[model samples]
Target: MFGVLTERQAQQEERLLDEEEKIPPTSIYNLELLRECKSSRRRWKFFCVLVFILTFTSVAQLYLSLSEFKNQLLITTLNRVKSAELTKDIDIIPIHSHNDEWRRLPLYDALRVGAQSVEADVWYFDSDPDTIFVGHNKVFLSSKWNLDDMYLNPLFSLIGQNNIAKRFEDENVSTRRNGIFYNNLHQTLYLYLDIKSNSEKTMAALEDKLSPFINNEYLSYYNSETDEFVEGPVTVIITGNYPYDYIVSKSTRYFFIDAPLFKFKNDEELAKYNHSCIALASSASLYQLTESRRALAGVAGLSEAQVDTISSYIDIAHNNDIKVRIWETPSWPVRTRNEVWKQLITLGVDTLNVDDLYAATTFF
Candidate 1:
């Protein structure tokens, strides 16, 4: 019985050993899988950290670039404002050069001295109405010295070179035209067209010559139908035998008439003429003020009666928004001319019509 029990015990022990071997192999396979999973997880974590670091670096670089651009824009704006403030103001009073065509350089010399207004006496040939001439008399007329050749063409060229339209656009200004002087921005150069020939025929010729400027909007013109004056670089005022009845009848006029100051006795008469639309300025001879003063004093020596007469005319013109200009004032004798100019300035004359541009500009 003892021998049988020992054999049975030995068989049971063998079965237990087999079971232990199978369990250990299975456990080792599970351990290997677990080790592979841990290795994969560590690699994935390292990859994620690298991606995070790269993303942080890219965002930081983008922020720095944007900040630099913002600073540059601010500096450019400040410099522009500073440059504008440094430019000086051109403060010149209105000075008109009478018989400006008679000067050595018609418009150029007057412009150099800062003469805002200039006059040209123009005549059209009776035989050939198309031909216009610029001169004090017909004897001095030349085909080469025509209005367009002398004034309009050169003016157009200057305007093109200056780029006036762009400058005005930048300034946010639309009303007044740009002046010839570079420093003077908003002042329009007044061009007095003194018609010396037949009023009707000469005007037609003048229109033809001025058509280019009018078309390009370089010349100011009054639109009677709209009752609006279109401002431009040059303002043309017609004088010397201008047809008043014909001028008043027009629906639109490129030329403004020089109304006779003597005709209007009071503001009521001046208003009735509609001087604002038809005329820019009313002009008269200094002799027209009083007969006694004309015979004895001229413009230099004026009696209180003459002074009152002249003052009344100026007042009447001013009431109608029309500027006053007195022609045929004393020109000889420098002292007398200076005295007359002083008197005229004191009287608040809108423009001093002087033959000597230098004297006029230098006076004040």
Candidate 2:
């Protein structure tokens, strides 16, 4: 009786059997899950590749931008040499690095940013006349960091690097030797020497040290007999207790005097020197130039009187064919510093005397 089923019970049992067969087998269920996983893997791969492409593009843009200085127009021709850090597309700017020796990387730092002028305070201790020590004062000067070690040798190396190809190239490619910059071959780099010790001994030591550059025709020089300035890769400008008479008196000299802006009473006074010698740069302390006892600008920016005085001085300098640079400018209060810098630039100052290269770069 248990084995035998009633007709109605047999029909119900058959319906249950049909429903069980419609359900997928265990193997088929596992196959469905595998298909879903494959689709998910494809999507994940696409997303990763998209992210990688975007990230790579962003990094490339930042690399080119970080290496460029925005102070001047971009020079794109030198992209061939962009592989090197210093050989990036560097645009020459009229920024002067004041107290450049105080920087972490003296000549190289200024050059990387395309600073047109660099300052070095040279102190000659009589005890060792062989070396011209570089510092604001002898107390903190390092013997290892002399004029030759700090600037001369490194500069010559750069000059050599720039000129290597010229030696092998055809004469039509370039008739003259190149400068330290691969981007700007003709631009002159000013080396400002602030004489901290006796002018006589320091100049003598400097002449001896510069012999290598001089012999190589790498220095901008003034020939007294010819009364013409021969432009070169580097121009030496002497300031601060620098024997002005000595530079002017010499028949032939490699360096020029940093014309004291205060010494000239007016344009007429500037005219006399302009015709007589090559004073490529003129510098004055803000106090000495404007007769201000302190930083009168004081966040408000320079006064009307100060602005007028400065404008006149810059006009005199330009008319006389000299690049005027004003130092002791206000440093505090970002707004004030920027304001003064803008005003000076508007007034036609040739170069900004700056201790902060990064800050100054923004203005140009």
Candidate 3:
């Protein structure tokens, strides 16, 4: 009653209400005050985000340090023993060490797990034909990462040392040696060279680089004239922009071509190329085999229909004694990855293309 708007005051009150109804400018909750509160909240949120990122980065670095230490420890322990006895007891597993060069010790790490196959992404420029660079990318490559030094030298030395065939002979490396794994002498080690740059130049360089292995008769070769496969300590299979025509045209060649798994229609289609020319076939991804969303039932793995589709394709390859490998499989949620691996193995996949060498060896 004491502060009620009078008739004259009512006009002024109504005008002020119309102007300041949404945000009373003169009150405690003024526009400037509200804006200040909002700015404070923004600052607080930014601080929280900054703290989270810092904490996450610190944790990541620590984890990487621990992993590096662990890898080195294992390698050191393995190296303490003689090379001949090192891999003698370890059973060779049907696992392909994808991106072998990425490992802490490159080729040696793959050997530590007794992996049957290893992949090296090679980049050979015409200018540097004799010096083929081995890396996943050009930016990551160093002059020190020559193929002869990292892969060939290590493998050649190991094979030479383990060549029991000429062990008793006065001359060193007089005869073809046993495979890298003493336990599995007959099992051939598949050395997959993924061409990164010009295939012609890369493969041409490889032909010369492989001379030592060829001279030692340590490489598996297919005689086109006799249609015979002579298995040796090492088998080189070229992938990624390989010159299929150049390889097949050879009446006798040390390396074989990796056929596209999806290209072959049936057994008859696959029969055209036997072990002589094509020992293995692969798909870039499982999606290429079947884009069916059914293949991705998430944690449950591929649906029955989708699994059948995969099985059919696998069956075609096996029918002609050709091995099949599918890379870029879903690796997350561990459960799904294991399920897919089990399925592939059950369906008779020749080799499991894996990032984690130890994990794949353990899974099998």
Per-residue lDDT of 1-364 in model 1, one digit per residue for the tens?
9999999999999999988787878797899999999999999999999999999999988997777566545433332332123223434557888998777666665665777788999888777666678999788788857787667766666654444455554657554445455676556788999998889888878777888777767788788777898777788899997877767777877888887888888556666565446878878888766543242455455556667778988987888888899888777667777877887887878999988877787777
Residue pairs that clash (backbone atoms under 3 angstroms), model 2: 71-364
Number of the top-ranking candidate, with lDDT as the measure: 2
Question: What are the per-residue Cα lDDT tens digits for candidate 2 across 6-117?
Answer: 7779989999999879877986688888999999999999999999999999999888777544411232222222323574587778889999988766777788888989
- lDDT leaderboard ranking: 2, 3, 1
Ten-residue region with minimum lDDT total, candidate 3? 275-284
Q: Count the backbone clashes (under 3 Å) in each candidate.
A: 0, 1, 0
TM-score, every prediction? 0.69, 0.74, 0.74
For candidate 3, the per-residue lDDT at 310 reads 79
Model 2: lDDT to the true structure = 0.80
Alpha carbon lDDT at 41, candidate 3: 100
On a 0 to 100 scale, what is the lDDT of residue 90 in model 1?
A: 32
Model 1 lDDT, residue 334, Cα:
76
Go through the candidates in order and give each one's C-alpha lDDT: 0.74, 0.80, 0.80
**Candidate 3 residue 278 C-alpha distance from true site, Å:** 3.3
